[model samples]
Target chain A: MMHHHLILRVVTKMLVGTIILFAFYVQFHGDFSPGGGFQAGVIMAVAFILYGIVFGLNKAEEVFPPWLVHKLAAFGVLVYAGTGVVSLLLGYNFLDYNAFNPGHPSHGQHWGIFAVELGVGITVTGVMVAIYYAFAGRPPPINDEDW
Target chain B: MVETIINIILFTMLVLTALAIVRIDSLFAAVMLSGVFSLLSALLFVTLDAVDVAFTEAAVGAGISTVLMLMTIALTSRTQKKATRSGMVPFVVVAVTGGALFYGTLDMPNLGDPNAPAQLHVAPEYLAGSIKDIDVPNVVTSVLASYRGYDTLGETAVVFTAGIGVLLLLSGLGRRRRKDEEGDA
Candidate 1:
């Protein structure tokens, strides 16, 4: 649908890689920085959404299928809850990180935080992309000239 | 002093953008202006030392939402219907709410007051305990993930549920429904 927009396509192709790289940075380095899973996930979703906009929704869906996106959205929640369940099984309070590393509780905290943040990131990315797909797949009621 | 000046500039821009959004009849133009409004709010958040919030606002508010709204505009009407009724009711409600909010602020602490009740409350202990327990350089992460992990878990579930809800409502484009309808027919 956006085939004639060569400039947008070229610019998006260039920016997508950098956007993905920055999203990863925001995701992993969040513990020491301002960003975390939520912001990183949105940023990550932006990369794919931009690609979908410049190219076409079908190509974007092919790269990341809608079924996979739905599964991912749920899987992220499982990853988050599973961490707490692990702590519970290990004889610590739910979500208590001390269960991970007996000798160093702080390291345990780090691991637990990382796991949950990853879960949050995955879920957010899935949801955002899925919404984008749903919206873009629909037939437009009017032409560009209507606006 | 410099921060205050920057804030004033951002706030002015924000008001101007909001006024434009309200007055504009073209939904597309309104959507674009709202994106600018979000960007300005993100900048204001930065001045307030809330970079994490600013980041989210910039990404979700300015970037993702703009795309989403544009898609919505495509699916719906391009121009908004003019309101047939007078705007007096909404104006009175807004004025009353704003006045009440201004009154409520009179009892609140000033910006960054050292002796504010919130500063003396659990915030101190949370800060101290976070350093000793979590040892994460970013206290916000530790607080959200470790200290208030249950809340974070709940929030994730909410996000998950929201995605499910949207899928249920807007997945009309999906072929599964059509195939099911055909089979039933």
Candidate 2:
């Protein structure tokens, strides 16, 4: 596998960085654009998946260990639920952003949306990469030439 | 006139791609064609002024799903098996389902009708109030992340559950257990 095509490796190296940068741009600029947490997360995962394909699953796992990925998935849900719980404790309805800033409700709404979207982005990136790992980690039943 | 031409061309391509997918026995070609189908629909969505939906369809449908399908093919088989019997029963079932769906669409409101029930309902308030309440330029973002936060949270949970299910099914838990037992011995 290490002796695989150099051109593929070089192209993947150049593309991976650009892909991750675009993912972040999509994640943050989503407030003003067509993308959001879901699109950004998938793009982020694609970076890792492409790396896994070109380098090898073991090398990709070294960069983003599986245990960390699992924890990140759970952590995203916790972050989202925690935002709602905070608003509830502040004497507002569940997920009421105004509770965060009583003097300036719209500001609070902005902050709340940002937090929740960030949580969504993290969870999506985690789950996508996890699924890819699950599929690619398996030993292929047939040889490559068989395809 | 331009919009109509674009719509017709995109839909024509979509139908042709779908037919090609059906005709091909090679699963790899089918997967690639399905990605093309997704891209065509994304273009259609863009023409309808639904940029967000188009972005999602292109990313998920054309990008990730294609990769996933390719991985699945690697795990399974490249070619589809030939049917041993006539396709009459499946054809009848598909025809009946398609007819029922088409019949259901007859009651749908016409596209872009301002007075349609869907447009008249919560949409008006969302459009009017989003800027004042959320101060966000993108109403869709404000609605998804702020006003309808609970629904988005539910969707995230659903994604989480699906990931856990796949991990349990395909992560080779039994193989790890056997390795642990061997170390103990």
lDDT of 2 by residue, A96-139 (tens): 99999999999999889888888898999999999999998999
What are the iRMS values of all candidates? 0.9, 0.9
lDDT of 1 by residue, B64-124 (tens): 8999999998888889998999999999999999999999999999988989998897778
To one decimal, what is the Cα RMSD in angstroms of model 1 from the true structure? 1.8
Candidate 1's TM-score reads: 0.95
Ten consecutive residues with minimal summed lDDT in candidate 1 chain B?
B168-177
Candidate 1: which pairs clash? none
In model 2, the Cα lDDT at residue A53 comes to 80
lDDT of 1 by residue, A1-147 (tens): 766778888899999999999999999999899999999999999999988877889989998899998889989999999999999999999999989997999999889999999999999999999999988888878764444
lDDT of each: 0.90, 0.91
Best by TM-score: 2
